[model samples]
Target: MQEAAHTGVSEKSTIAPRKVLRHSVRGQILDALRAALVDGELAPGEIYSGPALGERFGVSATPVREAMQQLALEGAVECLPNRGFRVLTRTPRALAELAEVRALLEVPVMLRLARTLPASVWDSLRPAAAATADAAVVGDLPGYADADRAFHRAVLSLAGNEQLLQVAEDLHRRSQWPLPGAPRVRRADLVADAAEHVALLEALVAGDLAVVESLVREHFAGAAV
Candidate 1:
């Protein structure tokens, strides 16, 4: 999926308005499905019909099928001939492998950023951090997921490397896919993750590389998501 960069798309950025009209419908449906996967509304291993999902999202089956096809390319789902798609299930071993990838990518960069970036750089992320906390307090898993993604993206943006951000962002999304047979998210877990972001930012501002590294490792170590 390294070629994903070839599309010249930053998942979070603004797009041309004309292009938005043509692409946003399918893209939005894809995003909604991704959130459903992470939020467990689309349970892993379940075969879901495009028409059925279209009914759920109030869209036509054509767009839903297109979106699911994109997700299938991302390895999030598998297409069945003449049928719908099946949500790909991730085992604990798979989750652990993903966590290891994230730790390798995120930890060292955070340590480097903590020492080099200015206090205001970390301060710039406070709004995303606050947004994460607000979503966590409300026990909104999808909301927290978005906010958490933004917060980490903001952090990695400081690296001045779009490729790094994109790669890490992809792994981050994969890591967040809901575990098969996992329990619903606990409010306490979201709150704890929010607190970790806060501390991570504080460490970044303090230029405490050790604390920043520790927090980054611990954050990925708890892989309930």
Candidate 2:
């Protein structure tokens, strides 16, 4: 009789487990650092040391160093020759340009999604937008920021185009700049934004692609201003 074939898991399964662990570690570090940078907890021009960050994150320096290198590659942080990592600061002009790019990329995708996706997806976005409005009302900037990200993500997800979603995400990250000494999201602005979302939802429900696109463009323009 032929020798019994091995019944154990394949080598690929063993290697895959380690790969997943490493990826999770790296992703955790990156997300924590990115949140700090965006929320102004890590100020512009502040130099970050790997050891310090590693300690703070309860990890060793290796993962933190890897994360910083990845961030530098993404242009979110700059590596000094001998010093450390510095967060990249965006100028007003640069922010405006990024906003324009975001509008161009996102609005069209949202419009297409609105016209094509099922109404249920649009309905699901309402709660996220309402939460964003509530956060703004309570002066919870971080909460508002989280909700804002969710709202946009929901809209992009409806597009059903992975490539376009990736492009929009890249643009969104680049658009995070200090708001010229203004609050990140003021109560009034939040209210207006919520209204705009409602209008977009109404247009989507009506299958009015033209109105949806116009509203999206106007919303971005208002935010950019």
Candidate 3:
């Protein structure tokens, strides 16, 4: 039998037990592969081999295969006959339609959360927003994408509606298609986005639902461009 390599554990071990670790490994592979596909790191129509992906992610083929199936189910990739998975191509019109759907779903959620949730609920969002701003400033597209998603998720989570939150998250995943092959980060866009976030924070603090809705719409519209 092959012996598993043992690494020294840290003093503060937040690592989950074996079963949880296996689940997390699968999730990590899924998310990483999805991000790569959406960000255009893996170009549309590009074929990917499970074994190669597993090697790249430093995991076994089983997890990579699982992740690919998940991506396929999400419409990010497709299983090809006698080949491997291929990234799905998205049209500009499709992306525009997706943006519209996201705006419709998310703006209302943000408004409701702003009106209902306490300021303390937004404490977690501040750091994520700040990180996004920093990433945008530095032209770190991958980091910015992660932080951007986190910021939106934080706001959606505060709404306390599980169905809405899931829908919003799905919309967000779909929206990532437009970003692939786009410029890393535009300074002017970042500045404008940061300013909008500040204004949003202020609106939340003041418990202004109307302003929050308007700002959310504006933010999503700006991102569409």
Candidate 4:
């Protein structure tokens, strides 16, 4: 009976680790899929098979399918029965709408922060702001996306509202999605956007609310376009 008990305990221990490993693999695959989507490697409106993606990633199809399901839930893809996941074609109008909503949600908060947060606070954000510019210079879409979001999160976190930060981040991600049948994002565009980050930071540091508001509105308008 003791031997049986020991065997059962070992089995339970093994099961939990296996579950964790699967979850880890799924998370890794999901991140890769998101990177692919942002990089324009997975073209919009193109259907990608789990088996094929698995081959590319050197894994089995199960994790790829799981990751694709998550993307589907995020409205990034659509599942086709007996087929695979199709990357959704994002329209400019959809992007504009998302940008409009994001501006509404974030501009007021940013303006408030500009009024309240001191120069030291804005100065402290320079490194994160610079990271976005660095990534943009190299045309690293995935790097830029991560850095851009991180910079925004750093600025917004000053408001101390976790819920608002999360919502704004989601909107920001949606805005960055590659448009249908479009080539990769222009290096010029990324540079221009990255410049706005620097401009906004400077405006905030100088306590110039008018410049801040203008920059913020122009930033979102550029994002929408």
Candidate 5:
């Protein structure tokens, strides 16, 4: 029952979904851990035991361990054989490299799609863009992250390259994890970033390739989760 885990568990509201789904306990815990990572609840370099987290979440240590293993696969945590799991520290250089890679993979595809995809396709993503904005207004980092990814996924799916889309998404998720010594994320920052989705969609629908390209690059430049 370390204080850090208690603090993380107390702020679990940031990770809780509005509506409960049919996810298994392990699946649910996995989502919760990811959200916690995004919100900086899981402090970098801190080791948390599965049994302790399981006790807090009211489940067996087995489920928590399973979830932690999944996170380890995602590079979010490292397993400590005789202890627990340690959240990995992400450096500025690493984060910047990820953003650059995302731009490299997504920008060209999105720019090309802007020219050919019908306005209707862009219009369909409006709801997701709006959802991100709404989540930001309430400082719901986890919700904003989910909505943001959904919007990007919708746009990239148009390229009909499932593998590319999946790889970009994995990078995007890692980008959202809070960096050590980073200032607490502000509501204004979230709102501005969320608005980029709307702006990008507008540019796509209006057939403004230059604006779309600029917006896409700008989006990655500030892709600060």
Candidate 6:
């Protein structure tokens, strides 16, 4: 078995409730693979076998292979010749380019939301930000990661453009994947990072576009996980 598919990894690090509920078995496998990629259980440049991943997830190899194919299509993993998939590695340059694109795409949208959206719209999204805070308080990286994305998604969804949201989400997921050779991020840092959401929310509520712009710009400047 490749070392990446170790069944003993903590339950939180693997796909659980949301993926299982919203996605097909193959979709769930694909999401798990993404989380594994982000959480560094599946290292860059490692070839992971479908059968081994099936054993870990308690699914058959067919679904695992299908899911892996999807990941390959997304360029998150590469389909090996007569084998399984190899996780792709990203350089600092690549990660920076992703962050740059996200800032270019998302930051302006967020600034516009802050300027044009009413307080009630931001009000409805407060719970998502709080959920991120809750996740951070407990030092839960996986939980924080999910909640953080939700909070941002809620903010972006207000633009009333699903296709834009979809594109932004793809970039977001790519940014979350682990950067090659970056140090393991500390849990305390995650807690600190989550705190910024509340601050950004406050700035939005206050209608301070300057602070909001700065916050949104800095928000995309996340350390590699």
Give the best candidate by TM-score: 5
> Once superposed on the true structure, which residue ranges of model 2 sit more than 4 Å away at CA?
1-25, 179-187, 208-211
CA lDDT, candidate 2, residue 166: 76
lDDT of 2 at 66: 91
Error of 6 at 95 (Å): 0.6
User: For residues 61-177, could you state the per-residue lDDT of candidate 2 as single tens digits?
Assistant: 778789899988777888765445776776878888888888878876776677678877687778877876787677654456567666787788876788977777777766654
Using lDDT as the yardstick, the better of models 3 and 4 is: 4
User: Pairs clashing in candidate 4?
Assistant: none
Ranking by lDDT: 5, 4, 1, 6, 3, 2
**TM-scores for the candidates:** 0.87, 0.74, 0.78, 0.86, 0.90, 0.86
Provide the lowest-lDDT 10-residue window in model 6: 8-17
| Residues 103-207 of candidate 6: C-alpha lDDT, one tens digit per residue | 899888898878888877777777898898798777766667778778778888899999988888888777777776666667788877777788888888888
- RMSD of model 5 against the true structure: 3.9
Q: Give me the displacement of residue 76 in model 2, in angstroms.
A: 1.0
Minimum summed lDDT over a 10-residue window in model 3 is located at 1-10
lDDT string, candidate 5, 131-178, tens digits = 999999999888888988888888888899989988989999998888
lDDT of 3 by residue, 1-225 (tens): 111122111112121212224557998777677666544566665666666566566678678788888888888888864356777888878888888998888876677667677877665467777877787777655566677777788777776789977787777777776444565446667667766776787778777777877888888887722
Name the runs in model 3 displaced over 4 angstroms: 1-24, 118-120, 179-191, 208-210
Model 2: per-residue Cα lDDT at residue 37:
61
lDDT computed for candidate 4: 0.81
lDDT at 31, model 5 = 85
Report, for every candidate in turn, its global Cα lDDT versus the true structure. 0.79, 0.68, 0.69, 0.81, 0.84, 0.75
Show the lowest summed lDDT stretch of 10 residues, model 5.
9-18
Candidate 1 error regions (>4 Å) = 1-23
Q: What is the lDDT of candidate 6?
A: 0.75
Looking at candidate 5, what is the lDDT of residue 221? Answer: 98
Model 4 TM-score, all chains together:
0.86
lDDT of 4 by residue, 32-150 (tens): 78777788777777777777677567778899899999999888989886667788999879988998898899989998889888999999999998998999899888889989999
